[model samples]
Target: MTGKLVVGITGASGAIYAVRFLQHAAQYFDQLLVVMSQHARSVARAELGIEVGDGEQCAQNLLGRPYPNITFLN
Candidate 1:
């Protein structure tokens, strides 16, 4: 098995930063744990216009690829 890492993203202006970081982290960790705040979600929608319907759909949008080592939590 490989190692893991945790990434927490709060309701900050730089929402893309978190996603971009995770995209890059895909190669570094076997498991990538992600946590996002309500404000972050709101900001993401407002800024990126990414209509992430439900939890599962939102998960797909954030990762932007197949279900890889990524998780989304509110």
Candidate 2:
């Protein structure tokens, strides 16, 4: 996938960084793929106060809205 951005969200201290990166990547890449680990959800809830469930729900929760070019990889 040329010019595509793949983001993996793990259990890191800076969930904000991932959020900001996604915002910026969305503007530049035509295709954006996001993979969120289970630990990432736990971190997000603790750090960002966001509870992300599994599968597409987790992706939808983080993104707020589904974009045409955005793909959620479970």
TM-score of each: 0.80, 0.79
RMSD list, candidates in order: 2.0, 2.4
Worst 10 residues of 1 by lDDT: 50-59
Pairs of colliding residues, candidate 2: none
lDDT of 2: 0.77
What residue runs in model 2 are displaced by over 4 Å at the alpha carbon?
Answer: 55-59
User: What tens digits encode model 1's per-residue C-alpha lDDT throughout 1-72?
Assistant: 378887787788877787678788877789877777778888788877765545656667765775567666
Q: Using TM-score as the measure, which candidate wins?
A: 1
Best by lDDT: 2
Query: What is the Å distance of residue 26 in model 1 from its true position?
Result: 1.1
